[model samples]
Target: MLLKKLQLKAIDYKFVLTVCFFLFFAPIVAAQEIIPDVVAEKPAEKPSGGKLKIDGIIATVGDYIVLDSDIDKGFLEITAQGGSIKDITRCQMLGKLLEDKLYAHQAIQDSIIVSDAEVRGMMEERLNYMTQQVGGDINKVVEYYKKSSVEEFKTYFADILKEQKLASEMRDKIVKDVEITPEEVRNFFKKIPKDELPTFGAEMEVAQIVVEPKVSKEDKQKVIDRLNAIRQDVLEGSSFATKAVLYSQDPGSAPNGGYYKMTRKTPFVKEFKDVAFSLQAGEISAPFETNFGFHIIMVDKIKGQEVELRHILISPTVSDAALKEAKERITNIRNKIVGNEISFADAARNESDEKETRANGGTLVNPTTQDTRFELTKMDPVLYSQVSNLKGNEVSQPLLNTDDKGKKTYKLITVTNRIDEHTADYAKDYTKIKELALKEKQINAIAKWFDAKIKDTYIKIIGEYKECAFANNWLKK
Candidate 1:
């Protein structure tokens, strides 16, 4: 588990990209020259507020990359988010970063992987939702950010994606397989004081029949040709950025005219990375294919080991025929379910392409918890779209929807239950406590695993951050 304990007055550090100072930036060096000695034993204040700088190399258990720039960027992001920076000590912040890295590093060694599409899909949905929440002025946000354009925003956001993916991978290892026996739940209840027992609610179970609209070969070729045309336009002197802004399907880069960062060995669809790494500085790529569709890439700049570039992706259009077929198939499934012929579970196993939930008997699983219950708080975008208008025992007309993944799909949902807000009980909520107990057990397992790793590994914290507070108690020694 990647645990971050933000003090109520704690300094919250997001993730940052570390940069080694080069002589090219005279101002960066000048700022450093005016600062206190790097060799100082005690923390000192800078001219602007009580900002403190630390010198050190910190490695996660599995040894994922960490740079001082990572912490520095985190500091900037933390302050930008209106965090209480002053009260949080440098060492305290460092500890959070270290904890994140430890889990991220371990996830890599554990062979936990999240797809690039999943990362970008999540990022887009979040941004879109936020934009909707705030009257859709994305431009205002970019300007307020002190970032000149959406390109700069994507650069900052990419770091966010990496940390999120790393955290997600770690969590899968920590919690995905947890199972709590009846005895364990009872024992956990005994441990919880009577007053502290978690309350439950009238939980609901839901089922669905899903159908994904398949893209046609013609649609795919059209996307490829479109990207090829864009590449040609760039070669013919039309601004590639302008074209991207006008037509890119990647919401993250579409508004920015396609400028975003690309780093060596950083996570990206292999095709995109392969095309990107092959280009020299300022080179434009021909159409390249990835699961997302076709992309045209332009290398903006190549810094020693990292490459920064912008790209435009054109999605393969879902054909009308394919979409109709998807809806018709799903509608048939829904009719069968409504008619009460085959069980929804049996239908899901035989027909639903959603591997995540089909195996669970066609029950809607909370993406965050993987539980087959409707959690009002953790409702996914897809679920919200389907369930917001549905009443219990009612089936939705086949909806043209998008899944958590970027693929187009149709959903025929049957809401099993809905309850107005009220207090909860054990008969209805034992599963919730059982889940908590299982999570607690998992945490204990991970803790034991962490201790064993610390005993076997070599770690060194250099320079200013000699003392740091990490979640792993072993770090204290």
Candidate 2:
């Protein structure tokens, strides 16, 4: 198994902040500059009496000061998520805070800059995730924060977000090239106590040749005609929003009457973005075909590269006859391979409509491992059922597969390999175990860099925090 791209779950505020930066603005961050560190401005609150109690600065890394409130908020967030407020946990959180500031300072010295727009985009994704968790209601979040609007909540978290993006970028810079060899992996696995060894569930390797049913000209015309009729209705004084609510297939924006607030750099599909940007304000586009089917769009307004738009997407219907015909065609191809008329690979290359796999003879590459093997537990449910009981070299009957976008395609499957559930084995589990070794090496590398930086940079800890056992010797001079 190859080391898969890291999948981050919500760990804590710090982890969520950093990882979300990685997830959301990944493409833009790569092309732009390394980014941020600073907490948002504290909104003005009622001042205490003349005998003011200042929130004392708890620690300092370089010239960046960590306030008591910062530590309190960090601790509160973790505890709110069921984490214990132990001394060690507090120490750990403080260490992270110091490290984040160090990264931000270094980023500034290195002249790495993240734009305001990037920060806003990152904040939007975080808010969206929170909104989803609370049942897709933004108002709940707003009420929780006692804010008038979602935008205010974003402003409150803006500085923290900037810092996270910067710190994450800096950390990535440190561990970008770390790798582990086979010997290291083996040694790492050997060190694990036998009782602690991981047991894997059933896994299988499957390959497929897929064929998408061709949309008949009649069906394609039906979609185009429907969109054109809606356009005609709009031209004849019917409200576009009303028609979109009734017929638009884009669920995301359809409920809001197909509205979208988009920037020029918004990550729309290339085909959709091209036509959307070309249209003048108040102009309606003719029916256009994209990968999602057909769409008729209208530009509500334009401000520089930013635009407000409404659209109605109409996906072309796939007739049952067309689906049956596609299944028959694939079924015949599978028959040919089984009858030894042509090899599976030859048939795959000649007949498979899946361009991504056809050239490789229909070998399905596991997205997680980048190998031809798959962990059956992780395989698509629809695909899994077809290959679950097949022995080695056995082909599966024709089955329908639906992609992420709900596009239907038919495929013939072959179970190329399988592994029974078992405890970790050195030879059999080398690839899976290699990831553990690589992660350990990467952690050590980061720790080494951090220790060296602590020595070279100005650092201070209050007497109270100094007593706690910290992973890093922050007090070492």
Candidate 3:
């Protein structure tokens, strides 16, 4: 029913299509590429004549032409992504395509610049992800996508991705500054029918004090020495990328030869960015330490403000004695808080080793909402297991945790605030209501922009789709 409404309205078809694509085939390609499973499905309808079967242009929107195969491909993609095509007609697919092409066309008219490098970077990342999915075989990826060669596959999808980016940028430009005020939020809430008010789940604000196992001086020196040795090897003509693939401890980049491209504004640790920008092209830096571990970076190229580089990271091993000491330290801290010798907040401020949360009493901000409250139903399974049964203000026992990099730590957690499940209240749920109001405002802005643009733009829906009911005034009636 929801799909049918969206197909009829076409107000936010791109978002619905994106969700369907990502929910099933994300990290493989952008919404543009139809995987083999989708391409293999039979066409939605058999063409009446040989001309229709041979793939002809169905419609033209501004400078773009909609191919007959495009509608077929859209239907196949929907089916492959687990969407039912029973009610989704060819005319609806044409409407969505027309909308997309209109946005891309206006983006060009508005001089929105999506650089070739940006498109290439997106292609490379998708290629890498697809390769990894097929056991690091590029050949398998080409075969899976039914392309003769890797370059052909990338070239075909690059155009699709570029247009997708342009459409996205135009949509963003329409509502980039859309804002809602408190009164607007109140009114938006008031307009909602009483029975339709949303129910918020129980939520908790959690706090923790963490103590990481300290690496001994010898252990630290060993890791630094290892990094220095790797740097020396690279300096003596070893390929840095190959070395990174072989030895880099950073999992996120190791598979891609530790490759990273960043500008001064990239959200890397200050130390990493500082070292990256300080060196000229081809110069390798000495080992530097960040919270993740020790890393040695080599600058590969500098293009304007962006620097392309490779790195190797090495984390010092913690001894058994060090782990035991960390556990004991956290255990003692938990005892003190339990006995009321010191408040958890003060202890966290004074003694917690986790730098990110040590201040502000070790309170955790939910990444999803940028707030302190975490809905219990949506909590991470491991976190839910730890805090689900605890009573009010009850400090949990020291829990051992290990990070992806195999760094071990001990921590104590307590629920600082608990919000029970309830229907939305205007004053209590103002933040959430504000978000809803802002989103609605943005949607309205986009819809208005589309309505006006469709009238001024050259959009001719060829033969069959001319009679289809469209949500927007695409026909300029």
Candidate 4:
């Protein structure tokens, strides 16, 4: 679902996907990636609002004023969930803020620089998300902050983006080269208490042979003819909404006349988003084709980081010939592997397009376990329909398949790996445990680094936040 909306650059998505796999299988990744406990401590009081001097300092860590506005904005963001700020101690959060600033400031002094494009892109993704989370009402968000408009809110958002980016950069730098050996992983697993072990999610092993709705030259021409007629209607006073509601087969949004709030970073097919974003509010898009089908979009509105756009997706039913051809291709590939003319692994690399598995010798890894065993429910329904009973190395008949993001395709899975439920042994799950041990080691290392640096730097907390749940890493000075 997230992939559909956040259609990241393929390379970046692939990189993140690799990390996801590492973390899922390895314990250290989960521990290190979990959101840290955030809190802030108070500092020695300064008399009410005495304008702190501009000595290039905001809130001092030991000697650091974290920018006054940074504190206020941070509060606003977290507090946006609503309710009195009472239950969640503001003082504690502020102390966490101070610690963040201290690290952020240090990052600056160390000459860290964030790319403007990267910062802006992340900010856009987040802002669009916030806008939607708050009911896609940008005005309400602007009003909440009492800012002049959505545009005015960006300066503060940018600062927060910078802080986050800096902190993340620091974290990544510390952990980038960390590694875990199989032996170490085995040792860590040996130390786990049974009661505390993480349980797995449901899994699935699915196969698919897709039957695409192929539009022949004649059928495609008919579609074009119908779309053109609709466009002509729009030009001659017929509404796009009514036509879209009637003809669009992409069921996700056809009911509301085909509009959905969208952002640039989403995983919407590239062509769809590109064409959609290019239109002005009220402009009717020319007919376009995506794997799903043809579409005619209408741009309803555009907020700074988000947009309200709608479209009608019409899928043309696939022809018998197309489906037959797809199956034949799959069969040919499968036969070659069965015949040993080519290895199943090589056949997948050469013939399959699943980037996730192809690079790994076509191992069908469980999305949840990052292992071969799936708990069942996690499998794609269409894919699982075909592979339900096959044993290791057994091939299934071709069945209709769709990618996680819903691009329809076909597949004939060769169930090359299967594992039964069993108690995990360090010998088997060592790769998983090594990850946890590595992260624990890295965290301690980073904590010590921060502790040592605090003594060498000017630090101050204005509000006595020092007593709060500060990362023990920050208190060493």
Candidate 5:
């Protein structure tokens, strides 16, 4: 739903519909493309100590009541991103929020379930993204939200995130199977006036074959030895938390001194959880290996089936020789493909270490679209720059980068097709135009759904808000 508020230029059909629905209805304010820096608004002064406004129910839809503070919060959030608050804008925001509520309510009736773990995972990802946006300072983020700790902020926003996710899923269900035929796409393009056609930027279908350097057993042993030393130090009275903060490679937990709250039900790797749970409180475990790396865990507390633990993880270093070997391997593979000794797809299928792309013969899928095509602006700078100069069917020299798992690897890129910036065309841009048509169809379908839904659901607006103009048939009753 936050994505619905953002303007996106990429050509993912799903996201195209997401933002398109918002585009169909005029917004209260121009929504910010980035996450707004939400700051709480102090109330207008009434007396010596500025009497705060009491939050009360301002509207109701179905079983849900929209609180005045909800509007205030929305106002603060949108206006923080440079939106202006006025009667019209407030009304528009209320309509959107009501629409969101309707979806959430309907989701409940449909028996759609969103798990707590999924919500928590998404919350963590969003928090991590926010942390990165603040230049990796979690403290600043906490300060921005006026929260004492990261966990406090998570607790505060957890419900909001869950609602947003539920609303999005509901919206997706409404238009999930929306499609447009060739004739529909052609007719849709024809409907666009000659002077008003949308222009698209240069995009490419790029593929890559990756080669990860294998860590030698000797280097793996070195990592094991280092972890053993750290374990010995902890056994000799060194603080496990201090050692973890100093040396643990797991960034997600290292900042908290490798602390985790886990239960048997909590989804941790069996190897990690088993060792963690077996240890007595304040006991340290010997170094053990997981897919991420070698780890030595300390059990801080155990409450029934739940365990509180701290761990120090150390990833084995990939030697320069191994990196060189990876580069050499990719280079040889690239040469073989270029010399026609092997096809690029065959080489990718046989040799690429990237599991996600390997099955598709190294076709790089756009995370948003699940397609091989990508808008150049959306690609990583290194990937874009390397492929920018290459013609269709040309391959790049071996480039070094970390893979999705954060392992160092060497890769070669091939640009299969390139489409330059041009006004939308029926022949050349069928998929793009079809998505646009589908979006319009989705908008109409949703509008009809809303008309029927609002008519059936109970809606009560305060007298003050009743004066504001709403774009929807919200006041039809």
Candidate 6:
């Protein structure tokens, strides 16, 4: 769909630049003020032998300054991430840098505080990823980034990351309250010429009833006991990180020694947060069960509302008998639905084990669009494979599924709605059309905010950069 394509482009524009900026680490130079109309001096004659050119400030937006080297660094960052700089220019990089500075500066003026702990946690994760990329060699990271040591690299990037975070928060604040009404959605759709109406891809609404293999009490106890044993080892002078690496079943944290920093507002499960917040620094929590598995957490430090901790998770092993039983259960449910003895939605509500879909009568909401319809081309590969061939009210045979956490389940799926490729219909595609309208409204709000801010905020473009055209009025003219 043209609307879908626009949405993808907008998302790429929003995130790609920020990601490129963070990928390359550079030294921040001091700001030097120059009169707005003053032209920067050209370099004087050099010796026959080549000499290094000096870096200087090219532009200043509010309290932040853009360095000549920053443009070069931006190019390097993009190239490092496999992006082409063939069509990119220094002027374009400078414009982006100026925008980011404006946002960051405005954020500080608004007293938007991003805590040091949050920045430090992000810095650590980035550093770990970098080091891992270089074969787990910290020295390679320093050498690749041309830093004298790891600490210097961390310090420079930490400041950069903080500014980036501030800029992001400020940008979000600009359009946070922007909303669109039904009239606006209709008007927005009406503005598109009939010949230009976007064609939506073939899509279908799929529903499923899942039955997870149940873990026996003994199997669950075995997991709890294992976590307890690991906790005892940590208390008796073994490294918790080492134990986590060896035994924790949580793939996300196991490699990083199960480290996580969290506050009360963090999205960790309530059971996990309760146990973590209840423990004092240096105290190890008793084994506890959550939907993911069982975990034993040790609080490393406490800073106000935030706590740094390490945890090891162990999921109970499902017996083959349990898997077979799950398959049989789902198969029976499918047979009942096919035979018309029970309605599919009613069976899901009464018999499905998956809490997420059970209450919704097994209907799946597409994560991307937050709707029931999934565009065939854009659907997740695994889901497409399962439901692609089904037509009408044909219920699929029980299919075994493995989740990201390696949990096993069996499901029966059916397609409730299917729409062939067609030009956008105002009444039928109202939800999608509304999203497009809302996004346009939000973009306008952001543009207006930036226009007002540019006037109120101090900005100066110097030298040859003053000639380059920018989407925004950074020169305040």
For candidate 4, lDDT tens digit of each residue in 338-383? 7889876677667775665676566676565566655566675644
Please report the candidate that would top TM-score against the real structure.
3
TM-score of 6: 0.80
Off by over 4 Å in 6: 1-55, 79-89, 130-144, 233-248, 251-268, 273-284, 297-311
Higher lDDT: candidate 5 or 6?
6
Backbone clashes counted, model 3: 0
Listed per model in order, the count of residue pairs whose N, CA or C atoms clash below 3 Å is 6, 2, 0, 57, 0, 0
Cα-based lDDT for every prediction: 0.62, 0.71, 0.78, 0.58, 0.71, 0.79
Superior candidate under TM-score, 2 versus 5: 5
Which scores greater on TM-score, model 2 or model 6?
6
lDDT per residue (tens digit) for residues 1-477 in model 3: 432443343445454455435322433542233355543233345233333433578778899989877777666656544566666556656667787798899999999977776676566657777776567777776675468997897787788778878888887788888989888987788777777678999999999999999888899899999999999988898999888878988877776678888999999999999999999999999999998889999988898998888899989998999999999999999989999999999999999998889988999988877778889989988989999999999999999998777788999999988999999999877877788678777767877888888888888866545566666777778
Candidate 5 clash pair list: none
- Please identify model 2 stretches exceeding 4 Å from their true place: 1-57, 62-88, 144-149, 179-202, 216-320, 334-346, 376-394, 421-430
- Better by TM-score, candidate 4 or 1: 4
User: Which runs of model 4 end up more than 4 angstroms from their true locations?
Assistant: 1-96, 130-137, 144-146, 190-362, 366-407, 412-423, 473-477
Candidate 6 residues 348-464, lDDT tens each? 999998888999899999999998999999999999999988979899998988888888889999999899999999999999999878977877686788898999988887766
- In candidate 2, what are the lDDT values of residues 311-416, reduced to their tens digit? 9998877889889999999999989989999988888899999887899888898877776767877887766778777877777888888765467989988876
lDDT of 6: 0.79
TM-score comparison, 4 vs 6, better candidate: 6
Looking at model 2, which ten-residue stretch has the lowest summed lDDT?
1-10
Deviation from native of the Cα of residue 207 in model 1, angstroms: 3.5
Clashes of 1: 6
Clashes of 5: 0
Whichever of 3 and 5 has more TM-score, that candidate is 3
